[model samples]
Target: MVSPDVFYGALTRASGRWPLSAAARELVRSGVPVFPCVPGGKRPLTEHGFHDAATDPDQVEAWWGQHPGANIGVPTGAPSGFVAVDVDVHGPVDGFRGFSRASRAGLAEGWQFLVTTPSGGMHAYYPATPGQEQRSWQAARAGIDFRGDGGYILVPPSEVSTTGAVAGYRLQRFNAGASSVLDSDRLRDFLDPRPAPRPPENPGLQRQADMSRLAVWVAARGEGERNRGLFWAACRLAENGVPASDALDGLSAAASDAGLGEREITATVHSAYRAAHPTREDSASPTVRDSSPAAPDDWFARDPVSRPSSVRGLG
Candidate 1:
């Protein structure tokens, strides 16, 4: 039931003093629950984070009073009746390009509000349908992510540390007087596109079993080891004739289990596949020979007696 007039009025009134406490107050007055974040950072001042967002004038006043220069955070999804499609420009893939691709594919043709992040990324705001439960998620193999239920986005005029990667958030496209809502279904379809169906299973390939093992191996990798593990696994899968897309699907699941971030996992898996299958015919292919310690004719076999017993354990 929220109207754009309230937001536009607030924006006009707070135009001159951006990133100031008064601007955040004006946003709150528009019925958008807001919370204070640490100046120049996304970290919330409240202990419970976005859950502490409030529209109450007294609470907002107290929060801004405590931290005069705090940044503003608006919870997305049901809390604010909107979902934010976040395009990360700093990620390995070009987010804006991906979004453009989606748009060209007719997946993103709805009216929406747009905010440009300081990092040169973007947030596309869409009105959430009542009773629609959407969760934050990263689009597979893309630099895009969603901030929906249980998520939050920093509003425009909120400053991020210029010294760091992100710059700040700024209003980009705001239809001042119109209350046009974004098409939720279209946005969801764009963000979470279904994978094309694969051909009938081939019994001879033992593809399912191989993929299962690869998933388990990927899931076992620790933080520092995730990239290398996923890359090696992907290469091995490719060597076994598994399609790159299928391998990526399994690898993504495993990477998620290993607590690796979406961006890192996608980049690593893609890099590995690309390495295994050279894009150019003249490009050097990845070496996939078995180099385990147990393999015969290895370094251990070169000088079994002369080499130290402890050194034999090296792979």
Candidate 2:
């Protein structure tokens, strides 16, 4: 049901001639489903030749409408809202696994269903009440995939929005449709305040933060104090691509924000990098079954795709 090399075929379509990020490469290697994100409003060019942005409503409608054979299942409209959390783990962990697990439980308590991505990350879908879309995305814990009904569950690659478009994760546009989550009332009853378990100590958080500051100081050319942590995270993200610059101490305010010092940030990054080196392979989830092409969605009403409130795929 698939081409000779399903993932490579997908990657070839998504990445084109350009080099892929370590995270992107990881997805292709692992056979995870990946949707190449065209920068917002832009369309594909080279590798773009491989896939049609099935995401575009008109394109999807036209293609599916005519072919009547394509299996591109769109999500149903239901409760709509976004839940983004700025996790302050305060340090690093064996990986983000513990944090993701805890995050899902908290969302469940909030009466939301959960979806876990390949990057050991999770997205929680909550009741789309009145103020759902009004929430701020600053240090956002989640992102926008809103199509209104059933809305969008998978993350689309986006640079304008810093939501779920992380460097290492593959966003699966299920196309199989979504399954409905149970009543929010019962879920809420179970988790009145959505109490979340405390993440274990991440002694390396401060160091990672400092390193973040240094990277910001280097890239953004601002003072390092404000954007230090952001810089650190970005550079760490970059490590998956090309080698990073080491002379962070010499650079004056490139990556971090204004007012931060470099010595501390520089020292911290070095230490954290030493401790938390995630390999390209380390980011993989348990393999997806049935590498075969998915079944036709002709019997559309028969099933839909969604994160059932109680179910989560293993990472």
The numbered model that scores best in lDDT is: 1
lDDT of 2 by residue, 1-315 (tens): 122234324433543333333324333343342233343322322132222223334443343344332221112222212332222222242223433454366533342333344344444433344432221111212221222332233332222223455332233322123322223333322322211223324523533444444344345332212343333343343332212243243233543344445665554444333323434332211111223312222111111112234323221
Task: Please tell me which predicted candidate would have the highest TM-score against the true structure.
Answer: 1
Tell me the deviation in Å of residue 6 in model 1.
2.4
lDDT of 1 at 125: 73
Candidate 1 lDDT, tens digit per residue, 1-315?
345556546655765556468888888878888889899889988877887778898888888898998888988878788777788776466688878887787665453567788877888877766786666655534677778777798886788875456466766787444444445445544654422223335533445755676688678765544565677677666555565667778889888998888887767766665665566242223333223212111211110011112211101
Once fitted onto the true fold, the runs of candidate 2 whose alpha carbons sit more than 4 angstroms away are 1-59, 63-79, 82-108, 136-315
Assess the local accuracy of residue 292 in candidate 1 as a C-alpha lDDT between 0 and 100.
29
Mind sharing the TM-score for model 2?
0.25
TM-score of each: 0.62, 0.25
List the global CA lDDT of all models.
Answer: 0.66, 0.32
Q: Which ten residues in a row have the lowest lDDT in candidate 2?
A: 297-306
For model 2, state the Cα shift of residue 209 in Å.
Answer: 20
Error of 2 at 187 (Å): 18
Off by over 4 Å in 1: 163-166, 175-253, 256-315
